[model samples]
Target: MNTPPGLHLKIAEWMPENGEVVSAYDIAENFGITIRQSRAFLTILEKDNAIETRRGKVMPITCHNSHRRSTRTIKVISIDRDIIAQRRHHYNTYRHCPLKSINGLSRAEKWEFIIRNARRRKK
Candidate 1:
């Protein structure tokens, strides 16, 4: 399947590795893609280490194989302090940060940036 550009990143950022049980139908309905595409996306998520196994299952979905069934709602993962800090450290910027510009900045560099900004703000 020809995957869309940056689709994997979007999926990873949206879905937690060990959180939530989303149905394939839900994924398809929300992403406006087909069931086959949704299944493929799940595989891609796994490869990228995006989704983690929960109870020995990556994502246990209901009525995944049945398209005729009502689409299940997406489960929202409860964000804790660790996850928030992780997102901040890894992302190094806003969630929808364009080009992930700040991610590559080192800790020292980030400190310097903060100091520089603080100095500027003091003026």
Candidate 2:
């Protein structure tokens, strides 16, 4: 199915910088859509060759107010390589992370490293 141009533009704007991952929950919340709709939209993006996605493990959470619980599976989406390279260049030039070898680190670990190093540099 073809996504509307306006919605597509909004989705693109809401996407994380290339190389960063975004969850379907994040997309749904940002776009004021249901989780299922977000997934469908992402699938369309993938079909259109606009993004790449990896299925992540499901997590369970319970609401504080309600007795109901739910499981949510996160889909990690990444933008094009060229865009990721450009973003990495920008990070390297301005927000340099001291870690010389980020080769094997997981995405969360890399983000932690960047945040920790950036915070240390500020002090």
Error of 2 at 6 (Å): 4.5
lDDT of 2 by residue, 1-123 (tens): 344544744575456443345556677787778767776776665564545656455545454753435443433365575764565467557755574889899999999988887844354
Q: After TM-score superposition, what is the CA distance of residue 102 in candidate 2 from its true location, in Å? A: 65
In candidate 2, the residue pairs with backbone N, CA or C atoms under 3 Å apart (3 or more residues apart, or in different chains) clash, namely: none
Clashing pairs for predicted structure model 1, backbone only: 17-52
Report every candidate's CA lDDT.
0.56, 0.59
What is the alpha-carbon lDDT of model 1 when measured against the actual structure? 0.56
- lDDT of candidate 2 at residue 58, scale 0 to 100: 56
Q: Write down the TM-score of every candidate.
A: 0.39, 0.38
Best model number under lDDT? 2
